[model samples]
Target: MSEITPADFALFLLASGDMQPRKRARDQQADLAGLELKRHVLDLIVSYAPPADALEATLMQIAQEIGPPYGPTRALCASIRDEFADAASTPGFMEWLIEEAVRENAGQKEKRRGKTFNQ
Candidate 1:
């Protein structure tokens, strides 16, 4: 698996919480499922490859802004930052994350397609 860069982590963090307005009921369900999956993926990443102090602080700040209900907390962010070595040590974990991300993006694109008729 390719290395997981800081930018990748940040982008995933940002994208995972994105919520679009005016979604249909089915779309909302899919969005929720996607969000949950992303969150779980984040948790896995944290568990394996904790963040550095600066990155951890940034994550905490973001999480604070994201806040309660469905959002991750500063404590949760810290927890992940403190435990990254596990991810780094695990075989195939990084590959799995990249695959999951690609799949998620493809699913999102499919969801965004408009109806069409063959001529």
Candidate 2:
């Protein structure tokens, strides 16, 4: 099997929001790979996010806050987590994240209201 680069792994971690300020910079060397960082971060949030089940509940609450589509994704989770299932911290949270991504994309296609038509 081809080894994954630390840069790539860190990119994936950043994508998932699992990265710490120092750790991100430390992953520059292409040697420290093989570990999934995103799931690690998600687990941290799930276990330590103050109030049990905060991620799941926050997702829904933010969905309501952002007000549909855009609400849940950014308003709720901030970024989408691909491996929510393997996260082991909270189950099914990734589903909500992806579902919101789809919804948010759909919502973006609708266009915002503010353009005055030129005669």
Candidate 3:
């Protein structure tokens, strides 16, 4: 594998925001999943950026990287919909908008479930 330079790693950290760790620390195997998800998001955002001009190309890349969100990722997105909703209106925020919708539907369904007891 090609070695990653510190500058590249720094850029990744910048792109990933709060997802990747900032300092060296003991990490578990399960931690890899979150890191991977962050990287996937970063990749999509970068690819979708205006200068890149490759939304179509990045869509395929994102699909290959993330596939359809599965159990945990779907659940995570659903749980954190409020946090992501602000970004939904951004130009390249389609995927996140989808997740926001997922979370919205999930929340609406939950509310309906609660109302069913009253009715």
Best by lDDT: 1
Give the C-alpha miss distance for residue 48 in model 1, angstroms.
21
Global lDDT for candidate 3? 0.47
Tens-digit lDDT track for model 1 on 1-119?
55565445535553431422345655476556555644754654454344443565556555655556434455555655553434457787655555666666777776666333322
Candidate 2, residues 37-95: lDDT per residue as tens digits?
33433444543443433445544554454353453244224442223324334455444
Q: Cα lDDT for residue 62, model 2?
A: 40
Worst 10 residues of 1 by lDDT: 13-22
The sequence of per-residue lDDT tens digits that candidate 3 reaches over residues 15-91 is: 33355345657765567676666555544455455222333344345455566655555544333333333333355
Q: In candidate 1, list every pair of residues with a backbone clash.
A: 48-84, 48-86, 48-87, 49-84, 50-84, 51-81
lDDT of each: 0.53, 0.39, 0.47
- Model 1 clashing-pair count: 6
Q: Residue 44's C-alpha lDDT in candidate 3?
A: 47
**Candidate 1 residue runs with Cα over 4 Å from true position:** 1-3, 13-53, 60-72, 82-84, 114-119
lDDT, candidate 2, at 78: 44
Q: After superposition, how far is residue 101 of candidate 3 from its true place, in Å?
A: 28
How many angstroms is residue 15 displaced in model 3 relative to the true structure, after the best TM-score fit?
4.2
Q: For model 3, name the residue pairs that clash.
A: none
Estimate the TM-score of every prediction.
0.46, 0.25, 0.33
Model 2 scores a TM of 0.25
Among all candidates shown, the one with the greatest TM-score? 1
lDDT pick, better of 1 and 3: 1
